[model samples]
Target: MTTTTSDGVATTRPAGQQPDPAHGPGTATRPRGRRAALRPGSHLFLVLTAAYFMLPVWWLVVAATKSNTALFDGAHGSMWFDDDVSFVDNLVQLSTRSDGIFWRWMGNSLFYAVTSGVGATVLAVLAGYGFAVYRFRGRNLAFSILLGAVMVPPTALVIPTFVMLANAGLTDTRWAVVLPSLLNPLGVYLMRVYIQDSIPPELLEAARVDGAGELRIFARVVLPLLRPAVVTVLLLTMVAAWNNYFLPLAMLNDPDLLPITVGLGQWQRLSSVGSGGEQVWNLVVTGALVSVVPLVVAFLCLQRYWRGGLTMGGVK
Candidate 1:
């Protein structure tokens, strides 16, 4: 006999035999629904992971609001705000301290990060597109070298970079920082992989067939599809440039050219000196809090592109 199952699929069975539970109509749907459900343990793990990451940020926020005395005294403990709320005072101190040099450091960081990030992103996109699309001599060999470069730790190269910059008489200048920051092998690799996976060669061929030149085809067709990867690489390069410490430290000796990372380190070292040193921990903490705001804003602004990319990938 034939009967319609719950999924509307018709099945045949013997006259007196019941449907087999293993091959029942709703069995497939049941497993799918079950697979979608999260167990209590999974929920617990997610909550714990979130807390682990957020706890330090929470402490930083609370510490930023506390007075120097309260910060060291543990009066309200470390995780909660002190009653006095010196956040405004800290900002004022940060603004006026050292002839408002903190703002200069911030401006330096902004310049380095933006210039390097844009340059790096442009290079990565171009190189990645070329690697993904065109078949050139030594393409695989060049990519292999790039992959090897990515495996080498960036810190390992700082000394050699400093030596090179010194040889070129570029040390202690902004170029020393910006120039080194522009070479992001990992970003290039990421873009290459993303382009290969997301952009089809047929689309480019179609654009060419429609009488589009290489430049026009890239700008009109390929670039629009590369938004997500572009944003990702931009953010990564910007953050890397902004947070760069060792390279800048080794390269720049002038206080006026220091980025926030090295500037803060200077303050920290001064604070650590025994009796003759000044204690500017409040300014340091406040400066750190302020430095983090730009990056957080960048992430918030660019997060939609990431979500959209994931959604598009899922659809494809």
Candidate 2:
């Protein structure tokens, strides 16, 4: 027997079979009862996982709202906001500290993340497309080298990178971080896989037959189709660049050139023995909170693109 759903998909079932206990009578409903039984357990697992990740963020939020005195006071609540709100005060303190150097670190982070993300995405697209479409000498060998690079840890390359940058007189500058960030081997691999799977050779052939040059064809035809992969690479590269610490720490000695990640670490260290030899936990918490807000906002705003990109890439 067959019946049409409200959405007009026809579903069929064998004769003499009763309706599923969880859903209606249809072939698709066979797993419904079992899935229903497992739903609560799955939901509980998801909730617990989410809470595990979010608990630290929640603690930071609550801590950001408390005064230094309240934070250290045994009588005050630890996980909740203290009696006197200190968020505004903390913000004021953080902004005025070190001649507003925290804002400079934020600007540096923005520059590095945005530029590196865009540059890396573009390079990945070009490299991925080349690897996927063109037959060349040592292509497999080159991609194998890329895969090997992916296996190697970034920390292992820091000393070597610093030496190279130092030799080129690029250390202690913005490019110290941005240049290294633009070389995302994983992004290239992802784009190669995505392009090979998602884009059909027939499309390229048709474009070629239509008298389009390789650059034109790629720019006009292929790029539109590769939006999902591009966005994914962009987000990944941006997040990595934004959160980068070690390279920046090793390469940049000037405080004026540090990214927010490194800058915040310095602040945390300074907080342990603040100016005039006093601990300044309020500034540290507030600065950390402020540093997080931009990245959080970026993720929230761009999440739709990120999600759609992943979904399309997966489906294709």
Candidate 3:
């Protein structure tokens, strides 16, 4: 078929066919123009953000390869490795120093992070599910209180937590750290929101119609659907427990019980004190590098779940 417009431009199409979408008015050209306008700025922003974050990690890597003298002496710049690289020497010193207490601190951090992460996730899942699924008297009030609790800073509660732990004879013990870490209000909030958004109530009602008990429905249906959110909450709580400093610092007095954060802080203080104090800045740098590896690996491994969860929640 052929047609002529008022401007006398001839157009042709196959018999009984529609106009080609690619040649449609403003369809391809408008999108291409918008993309062309946005791409440069977006690319620049992403590149700058990546450089900002990776710069510190790069410096840590370079510093870890240098010796104590090379670090302070300007033999090489802080951002580059020296010719006389002493990474092995630094690791050896790290292992031998203070009767290998660094390993103990690493182990303590792992324990606290894992224990608290799992504990907080379980509590959050149960609480969130209940909030999303069941309704009872004072439900709104209870949740309101929970939201208010979330607003209260964790640091502000540390003093009262310490007092209560001291009274319970748990201060300076691992429980003092792990117990306090398990109360993750943010995790609970996240789980509740995720549940409400992701899980359909009709699905649960269908499962109930099939004679599945509440526990069975949760285990068989809800959990499978909640995998992404669960992983997100787990990773968040784990990271929080891993990075927690003030709570452990106040609760623990024993060096043997200290996590990497406080242990490294002690070394930092010792290095800064006086001329007589030992300068283990190289060791400190190396330890910090080692401390970061687990978190990096964890993020790399779990990023798929994190991204999937966010995408799912956003879609819902």
Against the true structure, whose lDDT is highest?
Answer: 3
Decoy 3 TM-score against native: 0.83
Better model by TM-score: candidate 1 vs candidate 2: 2
By summed lDDT, the worst window of 10 consecutive residues in model 1 runs over 12-21
Q: Which portions of model 2 show Cα errors greater than 4 Å? A: 1-46, 273-277, 304-316
Alpha-carbon RMSD to native, per candidate: 10.7, 8.1, 10.8
Each candidate's clash count = 0, 0, 0
- lDDT (Cα, tens digit) per residue for candidate 2, span 134-160: 999999999999988888998998999
Worst 10 residues of 3 by lDDT: 12-21
Better model by lDDT, 1 or 2? 1
Q: Local distance difference test, per candidate?
A: 0.82, 0.80, 0.83
Off by over 4 Å in 1: 1-42, 304-316
Q: How far does residue 207 in candidate 3 sit from its true spot (Å)? A: 2.3
TM-score of each: 0.81, 0.83, 0.83
In angstroms, give how far residue 35 of model 2 lies from its true place.
3.5
TM-score of 1: 0.81
Can you write out model 3's per-residue Cα lDDT over 1-316, one digit (the tens) per residue? 2346558975432211122344544244466765667677789999999999999999999999888889987466888878898999999999889999999999999999999999999999999899888998988998889888888999999999999989999999999999989998766766777777668899999999999999999999998887767877887788889999999999999999999999999898888857567989999999999999988987776665554434432232
In the range 28-117, model 1's lDDT, one tens digit per residue, is 447577677869999999999999999988989999998777889856788888878999999999999989999999999999999999
